[model samples]
Target: MFFDARKNHQRLIRRAVSAALASVLIPLAANPAQAASYIRVNLIGYQSTLSAEAYLMTTSSISGETFAIKNASGSTVATGNVSATSGKWGSYNVYPISFTLSTPGSYHISVSGTVSANSPPFSVNTTSNLYSQGVANALSFYQNERDGANYISSALRTAPGHLNDANATVYKTPAFDSNDNITSSLSATGATIDASGGWWDAGDYLKFVQTHSYVVALMLVGIRDFPAQMGASSNSDFTNEAKFGLDWLQKMWDDNSETLYYQVGIGTDFTNANYQSDHDIWRLPQADDTYGGSDSTYQYIRHRPVFVAGSAGSKISPNLAGRLAADFALCYYVFKNTDTSYANQCLRSAEHIFDLANTSPGTLLTVAPNDFYPETEWRDDMELGATELYFALQSGGLPSGLPHTDPSYYLQQAATWAHNYITGPNDGSDTLNLYDVSGLAHFDLYRAITLAGNPSGLAVTQSDLLSDIANQIQTSVSQSKDPFGTPWAWGSSDTVSHEAGLSIMAREYYSLTKTGSYATDARRWMANVLGANPWGLSFIVGDGSLFPYCMQHQVANIVGSTNGMSPILSGAVVEGPTNAASSGSLDGMVTCPPNGEDSYKAFNGSGAVYKDNVQSYSTDEPAIDLTATSFLMFSWQIAGAPATTP
Candidate 1:
């Protein structure tokens, strides 16, 4: 595996002896404590084409700290001194520095003083493909998240689970206590649907369409928007991964009956033991089939329950219907040329699902235990769903399965929804994420109009869409006053990824007008997650030297690594940080926080705390929704660069 090879190479790479740049040495009254000096860098390394940058941070501020770049052979390639302080973030004075490394070799930046500072080892890549291995690892994460049989061996997966989903019994949505758990046995709808495959929503086995729809839309969106990098033409693995998601989504939506099943399995509960929840158990997915508990609870665990948003053929919740419509429509756009039959199926489903969307939906149906994923925005989802539907229909001639149709109707619907998004209350509440996608929808809609002779017939104009995109990005930029140039929101790692995605959209969308200010924002946000943030740790597992070793993911802890290295969950991104961090333990979980302490607590400040421990799901849990945007971000970077070097 490339991930294993990369780790092995790190051990053999030659490191040049550190040589410091000459400095005046008229600095401090006393020696600055080396314990307080540090260099935070992008642990995954930098693109050779981009100026390699890092920050020199010190708790006890000192001037004239000489720095040097050492290559594999312990020879200094570049040297400099900390000229001035950039600014104070948190408790340290940060010195932002940039240098060039033209050679492709192992290298690191170090400072010269009574007690010198050295950064975690990083590589300078001259390879045409900088993030291919990262992209591969990201895909591996999806493989690890896979549910049902037909599983292939992956970096950390050998067995598949949730096979019961193949012919899973359908259950009516159940009432719940405050914690989003099933309170009683669900009434069977006298139906057993083929709800197999797709992904586990997070570390747990429970799945939901609220998050699944978002993942599928984003995956297909990446393929549609950045085809070359995603290898849509040449690479089949990435396509298959997206198709894996599309297939599961199709099962969730019964096209012939206009039914949309929104969730599967149950979550946390204390009162319900007869039907024990997934969170109540700590084990692998394969163990679910034979799980034993008092009161014959394993049947519910074995034959997982599926829940629908509404009755069959009734107006589906706009959020699910809209996003599902977008997923199917995007499938049509992506597969139309290669597989006409499957593409036609996608188009048919897209049209039918979009038609079932309740445009005036209030208290939008998400998942049971409504607070878990309370989505308030639907117009953006409808806008994107309608836009992609329009794209599917604009393919000149309808496919064998598709009959004569007017594409303008969907386009009009897309425009109206876009207008509703702008005039709606949720406009600036969130950026590009599971709950919000207007940042992407508006950009694509703007491009579509611009490419079609600047369409003057839409309910919303190109100017309106572009302005919304700019405002969304600007709003995020203005609110990001933390150490890193990111908002550090709930699910902060995903926010970091989504912000980068938004930047990519802004960069390309505004390039047409040549005034786009998002030139380096994408790289900046990417850096925050890769490293270069307050903790000097990569949020992505297996991508860098320092990352979350004790992620809240049960699979990683129960069967994966403990030393923060390979055989560990590769490419899963942790929730970076939140205002209030948390932790928990299961009955049979491994003893993580091996040292019995949050090693990263010192760096936690600015109203957010991050813990690389199993307890802190708020900060270290890896979720499918969090990993989706990172894939988009990495793929777009590859598209901007060149061929992936896997």
Candidate 2:
């Protein structure tokens, strides 16, 4: 999960005219069997103000080609010439094209030439129609991912799940086999705690604080940044959903005893076939509490086991401590005015936990089976924790339970950590996904320096910190190999979400710097996720006509249809093509792909091979961490992303 920070200009103020330009891709040995033309586009609506882009792919290359945007009634609304062909993609010659339509209505892309074809019907709509629905659908994904008594009204998911997580048993982390399955029986700690009301980490029922805390922070940050877009706290909106995760996090963090429980339930247990684990069972989540089977086999499923990070009062892995602290500190900001008592509790937890960060860290704690998450760095996590703590302290009063400490102390700490992150080996390693939060931390710290009247003792200057985020975008842009202008790598679909966040962070600094390169990046990444790609598929479910129907999620796979609309897992973003598929299945589950057929194999390329099958976790598994970024990205767009000047 590390990157070789591609070197770029030392300053973010440098014009990225060259970074914005891209070259054509010619598939040298691409097949030439298909003769017809195909138009690839974003099936979901685009913002009327932004120039919508698509790809015209055919078997033959040509000149003097013109394209038109036609309304639902087949009337021409906009026209442009495809003067420059964009080389080759798969077996087709590609022509990159763009058009603008200010009018809000349904439309389609059309080419009037020798190689003529029509794109799937799309829309040019308002930001609300284009993004708000996406955000709402994303929230539905979270709700469907929800655990315990509080539940949302969904067509497929009606019952509450994992209610028995309340008063869940505590267990020691078990040893795992090479395949990441538990090898033997687990030992209980002779204790119990209420560990209910969080999200299921992914397609599986097991929950991990490693993934949960990251989701909680993103939700809280969205609630803080886009208060208007998130809606009222009274409704089942972002504030309510974030608070749901926060409440669960509070349960995980035993403040009185300084204990941090990091995981719940066990993974696959193939070593002892008699014993079962979360992955070994593939049923709706609600069935666990009411399971009808031998207690010895289903005990782990019905009464899940919780795993603590370490013993009470022990120093925590900086990764967990930092994010846990940030989650609460942001909670203090979001609720300080309306809910003073709750905000104080959040701030108090933040103060106590941030104080216990393992500054000189070794092995970072991600999941019990480290192979599952494989998080490498910790400084980025701590930097965000300190910066948000500083923000909470900068806002106003201290939590009543804690001793008095100056806000400047945290500000300097944040700066020092930011400096470490910038100079550290992982400086430009990643963007704002669950693993790397430096993109977000840098954005806040830059402004926090000014709020503190440009403190002289800080370790990093505003210029150094801002350039780091710019470098992340620079790296992604430079590394882009996809015909859609997105960088591709193994397990890179979520990386698109991360890169989109980096661009949005750069845009958040626009009023201060007045640059627009990141704005274009923001749109480009969104397009890739929404649908514009070689396969003409949307990585996010329920966003467009053509999206994943057989996601590996239990709820979706059990009750959902293969047709993409029988109560689809709306707004769930999945991991995309890693050029390989890991096909799998369990008993009593709907069979996806019917006979292991590779439906889209003809379109497979060097690093991109996407499958919409329940067995394919590589291309179909939707997880909490994977979908977290989409919530923020969609909200930012729904709010117009504000500064649009280039």
Candidate 3:
């Protein structure tokens, strides 16, 4: 290879020549003499960049000096003066200069100079390792969590069951009408649970949080909770009736994993992100600009958001706490259920979120009522609020010194609330463990659902409770009748949220005891949602896609149907807007097909569309009953073209 001149070489030659000439000039071809040069280099680290200094020096005086610096690849990066001061007789010279090296990389220094016409050439090599030990240590900690065995294995058992029990006053009792609307037919079991027409219906809200937790767990663990066999076998298999309804769970996990990282750089929000169709429903064709709108009344709903450090806008909002709470609980559950390898991964994910929350400038703690509204209350948000920070701390091995109290106490409190609010009031008995919401009900249910009969923690005991709940849920479903007198019909009213709660009830009922009725109701609920049109062609994607405009209703119907079913082998249909307001179809005749409204837009364009669209690929989430119906070809027609084939 051709050689490029270095800074030290030129400097040595200049200085050595000057000094040697002062005494005598060697013959044109005199033997080369040996000389040594000392070079000093300094490193500087800045918040955004770095700098370094290098120079060459020789024992004997030289005429002039030239020096060049090179990076690790030996490329001539720069050449500059070797001396800051010059000697009167040119016997000694010094060059001091500083340069920058912003990114992390290695570099080398080469020096060249001449003492006389025939001065000897001397060289020494220096290398730079740009990354600091502290940064490296932190990065290593992150990597350990990513690849460690404990990290991979721990994501199976840490979801929360009773998150919003304290806020139950807002949940209106179920009521539905004859038209399968929210007014007359809505029962805890028969109708959709979130018929109140609120942005966050109780049932839909529960499903969203549960789904969020499930998705977060998968994101942190980087693996599936159920065995491969139990994963989505077909589209309809994603229905809730299946014992292991965790098919779409993986896709949801991937969506979260990809988005959270992107959020770190570009920031988080339903809007203003490069979200793909599956990643975000906010930007979908069915979406609208309702994000900052008021609830039902014209008055503006509060809007607050939790933000990472360096976020440009207000940093006081605890808006992201609910979302974070869901994520942390999922992370904990996944870490607990999976192999040990997931522990470190869980820690890493939690740590990054925590760091962002803690180091963020102007951090505050507490979540106001309007934080969820994001309209009027957006300005009053706090930081380090409940759910996000509290559960996040617990996920990372329950770090001590929490502000409010110990995790055990919180868990007990959660359990007590769950019993008092849900099981106690409804069942007319206080026999259940009412003091274990965080650690027992939410936590235990998460574990039991994923374990698929594996015994661990409270799983074995919870199975029995699940069976009883399933029986009651079925009874409720069977007793459900519309005020207008319709039988065997679902959703006369808009209680979509109840679908999820019921699924959980049914799951608990069957999972704990393996009771057939518990599973039967679960199956019935899923079947009702799928309807005669079991595939996207007629059901969720096309005519019936926008069939039910309630998001909470949709979420409830679809939440737990991801595996081990047969009817929905293809997957859930994509619910879009429809022309339900009109009585005519494309032909505009009395015989025209019903012009369904876009289901995606009906719930005022909540992010529910994102979940419905991506549920098929989610590993832990269940596939819709429509898709599962295909797998159960023995019972239902494959084409889903109005019965008879089976």
Candidate 4:
């Protein structure tokens, strides 16, 4: 069951060296011969019950190929014939081979014949402990992405070169508005906010409230559903990670003025040179400020703008406010048992924001339009916020003198929101409907009606929600265009998020119906995210044999090496595979062609259009919401269903 970590590391090194040497020594003219002579198993290994897949690269079909799985003791424990499944990726034919391991231990696999290759040793275990390990690594990614004075401890740091950002203090003196217009009479002694914390939104230093709130809400839900799996104590990894975001969210809110800052700092589109200049610089967050100077260089500096309710440019957006309210309310519920005072503060803010959102309804927040995190729809956010607020009030003793505490009001609001978005006719197609937060709202309402024992005569019932989820899963599988059997589109991370979200829902459905297929499909999606793809690479970094290294994150790009040895940070899932249409935008950003372009010579044979380059933000940038949802999915998998469900 145990193997020396050092030996495994050494084996990886040897394989890398051998692969490099093979690439150099083998002539380009002999590519066809080399391709025809080797076989590759997509995964490092497989679980006891899962099917193992091996890929044979050849232009011509070969029959009767056999493969064997050997134990660490060099004994063949299982063997099977290679049955061709699909061959969409160039000349490679995928053969799915099945095997079972009753015991938990390390093992290697080999294909029989003249063109055989041995897989590196992998493990098989009965317990869902891999999911736990994955959660830990995913949480560690937040630590690695931490800005300000926080430094990841040596024990937890996967990429040691990624040091803490020295800049913690951020003094905001806005020179230009969101439209690049100069602001008249900008303050010299601007609001000195300690915007030292929060994970970067994606591939940039900007911290967005829209995306951050969604992530925080999902993390809370994960802990609530799988307390044991998520280690729901105060000092636990899940709680710690949630706290990092909570602290940042709290800082973003100015309680005295009842205003929330949607985002901090500008993105690359503002000024490419200034954005790139932050690289390799060890300075405080305050160093970017210009102290009300009219200099052009100072004008290009970052700005931290706040949105006040009913203000000229800051008219309250129901969705943005709803998201903020939900985030705070969930934080209140999660931390109430551990830190009462802090929890009360969160509840107060939640109520204030909820009231503001409910009272003022027009168009969503029109403060700024940053393509990075646009708030296109607000109904989902509104439903999620209402649902969370209802739950928080139900659990944390409804506070006196609060209109938002009416359980019937919130329940009806949530149900109406769900009806408008999810159960409506315009829910969109499977591929087009990438990331839907409305599902979470539906799930919450369903739980309220059944699990929480709340009373509401809403048209949306528990059975209806479950049926919709099942249909969505079926649609995803039926609509997938890839050989890997997972749906993908222009933005692959949306597919990744959708899968993770579906997995979370499937687990809940399994709990209600005791349906085995739900769990089976969930596991299949997880497998695809881990390794079961045409590229044979895990989208999650640092987990599988082949994973992302050159993530499009700015900090990671500056700190990590280029050869895919050191990832931006371990356990971070990048924006996954995109279609060929994305190549044009990516090509304009980087000097070299991004890795997965169809026109790229290397990818021509593989049919892969997803890239891991730093400039390929559409595909390779890691985002907070995706990480949060992925954490939820992994936690649900590890928790599994109760032995005897009601």
Candidate 5:
């Protein structure tokens, strides 16, 4: 109904203009009408204040467009004019509208006069259930991203169910050996390795250790900080999702050889005719191998291989190993009480990997020639692994096979690593401060100082770490240039992860100093992500009125189609808009509007650039790490007790 009015408005404008003028202007305004007149609101709605925006479809600016906020009883609660400050989308202008609701109830927006449109219904409430629901939905995304032994829960099932594959046993190709060495030809003696489990990295089926490690750490933090919020009840889905990744990570290690696999597969060639055939076809996990056929048709699936640790050809990536160590150590700390033997195993493996990584420094994981995740930094990973190992040893007692008999040795290692990281380049200068593990390193170090009892007695004091963290939060707040206060960067998806990181730091800072400044800033950032941005659109799918319907994810796209292509998994956060430098290169991938205009122009105006089309992977792909980070932020906001300080 909203789209019809927008279309009707466009038709009348075309009829009024000259044919020559209409030819150029119509295409700009004639881009497909969105389902809700580009009215973006928190699909889950807001509580204290109701904020939303109406994107005008017309190029000519209408000054006094009457907009009203109406309640479920169809009574107008508030009225205002569309803001004159218009967001330019090529020739079209998107208008802004906001109003405060006096009561908590279901509501929608109605625009009269020049632009006639109605928004989808939403809620206004004081309960934390919305955020809790967001966490649950975000965790469900991992279930949907599962590669083997996928979650079959009726409530969480978004993808087609399948049998376990490549986990029990997987064949090794010469192109990619067990030790991750690259070769020109297939191996003479085919080998089988047990490489199964873990989640697919993004819309594509590849898995990277760098990203996986980041995700696992965030989940562990969620469980640690808000056990009740993360469903600490027996066999909770949150715990189960985290364990899924941990189980797969354990398999990646070969104890005898002291090696770990960085990634399991390669992204399909984007230029190929069968660019995403692996996803387009509904095959089991093991189907991605040569066992089924030797024909050229099967080549795409057959070449997927696991990259392991070793030399230049088979580089023993310290960053990957360090992250793996951190994951194991953190799991040890969390699961030690319930599962002792399993926890002990994780502890032993964590210490071993940490030592191996520290001793063998320069062996970086070489990015497979065609692979996308090439990790460039190792300091943060090393810091996190050491910190977790120190805490695990201190809390859970010593495990057998450790290099040192004294737990303090591990503590000392952790403190040394932390000192180096804090003094290193992880200050707010680099955007890496947002998505990278440096913030985690700082958070863990702060915990070691205030909560964990600074056992190592390293040089830097607790006050220094707290000050640096406060400065980091302030820098992030100041850097946000958008009207909605969401920070922008080269990668919109990475920016989401970065925003989550800032929230994590802000919460920790609040815990330490009882200062509400960072916490208040953190809440605003969360609101921005929800729907308080320039686009007034929630970056998260299925959580807001104008959420992303057509994300660049293949599984979601196909699974969503089963439900008439609405959204598949709720609470799946999409990578938001990026700047020209980042999006310009991917212009060829976008197919919307057909005319090769800036793909960034695809979103409703407000300069909140993004595209819902499947081809716009840069701005629409939902990633595991990003979702994991969001889950952490949501759990903190919803599950943790309300802040007592201002």
Candidate 6:
């Protein structure tokens, strides 16, 4: 998906001013009917503190009238004193006013002016705080999956053999720089990081988890959604596509795409007719003219080989090809719990991938550029690979010869590394060594607990740790507001831009302990960040690249066609924040999470509050991943879990 300026753009900055200054235009417009309109302020690159002149144009003609700017809740934050001076041709003056949010919440502005009797009525259409609301809904959906309710119906599950369209887009493509070291393409859209979108293929296992809970519903949906052609397709096509997919995976492995190849990027599978042409047919749900070609090298890397490989079933390595399923499980369990059968399959698969990670396939242990982590990194592929093994161990599949003690030792060692950092004694400082988001490394502690077998071993301590982290995140959210109460993406760091990761972390915390302020904080962050869009709606930007504006992809409207109804998980469902029914509105499009709450919240001993509203997508509301998380939540509900109150 792509966007043009008017289609998607916004900005902001703040500071103090004693004297009157030139008012900046709050460029805005709206459709005659129910449509949202607002002036976007770009604060992403703004300095931490500063205030400036702000204005709102309410009338078609400059005249002796005043307009006011209010917080999204309709509280007057600033009022304009009109000078009897004619302004621009068709703009009313609401000028030289100052406002600040220096806290967390949504800031909404409305301008009213006394206009000529023949002119349009005095009305300004806008809303705020919807971002937070949207996020809360997304989080709630996630919590449900984490607890064990299938929010995404299993009816959408891809039958066992073909590539699920949900996980079929290539986020990043394997290419070669002048050196032939295998460079990667983020996406043709120019987003070079997976965070922006493109190349996130691990969603497959997430659907699998959701399916288990909503088996009947999923089976039914699958029967309706899966094409009859898939059932009638030649069985050989499945094998062929599988092989092609493997070769593509191998190329990715050979290339240092990210720290891990991560099963990211669009998939090329020929088992089904939709994707089985002589080329790697990249089909999105609604768009026509599938991407990918048979050409070897182009301005960007090419997927033609993948297409050819799919048709021939000649390119995949048996060992690597066979391991894809397990890899999927490892990725899913990072946040989700798993069952025995899935665990066994994942274990066998992980063992092989670990081997492949450590050694070139068919070769001895040798470090390479593509290894998931660098040898120099505190925890490299060895520890990380072991971590996957640990999950597999918990799932009940013990590998043939690998001693249980070995994994145990690795977990212990990982704990030691984490403990050393958290204890902070080495730095001779009173603060925990793991004070920054770098401390996110501590997430591994959860992995260790899973491996410890005695969920009680570090359970109590872990709950405390999570609470402590949640508090810090809350504090960050609180301070993020300018003096008025609008939450900024981050207070001091650029890296901690979105709260998606934090939401995931907080939800995970709640899942583990169901105790403390975790749920409250999780809900709060969701409310303020992702859920509280001005229209009180939420959206899912597809797994493609995030645009330059930093906002998630905000769909103008839901698809109204059968093509739109297909069970595809791309694009976010965005809600406007200004709905009167909503508690409030947020400042941006669909709300997104601030990136580094884990680090900031840890240092501050506080996090944002929990608040939220509901959201709507097509009949296919939450994507597979979101639905899987909902299932997890439902599971917890069924068990009647207790909540953690700090």
Candidate 6 lDDT, 15-125, residue by residue in tens: 111121101111233334311122223211111122322322233434454545455466765555544432221222222223333333344444443431111111121
lDDT (0 to 1) per candidate: 0.71, 0.75, 0.25, 0.56, 0.57, 0.27
Order of candidates by lDDT, top first? 2, 1, 5, 4, 6, 3
- What value of lDDT does candidate 5 attain over all alpha carbons? 0.57
lDDT score of residue 269 within candidate 5: 32
- For residues 295-393, could you state the per-residue lDDT of candidate 1 as single tens digits? 476677877888877787899888888898889888988888888778788888888888888877778898876766767888999999988877777
**Sliding window of 10 residues with minimal summed lDDT for model 3:** 6-15
Q: Roughly what TM-score does model 3 have, to 2 decimal places?
A: 0.31
Q: Which stretches of candidate 4 lie over 4 Å from their true place?
A: 1-46, 49-59, 62-64, 113-120, 150-194, 232-236, 268-315, 358-368, 425-435, 452-456, 489-495, 563-568, 580-608, 641-646
Best by TM-score: 2
Residue 582: error of model 6 in Å? 29
Q: Listing every candidate in turn, what is its Cα RMSD in Å to the true structure after a full C-alpha superposition?
A: 7.0, 7.4, 31.7, 7.9, 8.9, 16.9
What are the runs in model 2 whose C-alpha is more than 4 Å off?
2-34, 233-236, 270-273, 488-493, 509-512, 594-597, 641-646
TM-score of each model, in listed order: 0.89, 0.91, 0.31, 0.79, 0.76, 0.38
Flag the better candidate by TM-score, 1 or 5.
1
Model 1, total clashes: 10
Best by lDDT: 2
Model 5, TM vs. native: 0.76
C-alpha displacement of 43 in model 6, angstroms? 25
Give the lowest summed-lDDT range of ten residues in model 2.
8-17
| Candidate 3 per-residue lDDT over residues 529-576, each given as its tens digit | 332111111122111112221121222223212111211212222222
lDDT of 5 by residue, 413-483 (tens): 66666566567665554332223466666667667655455544665666766776766667665655443
Superior candidate under TM-score, 1 versus 2: 2
Per-residue lDDT value at 299 in model 4: 45
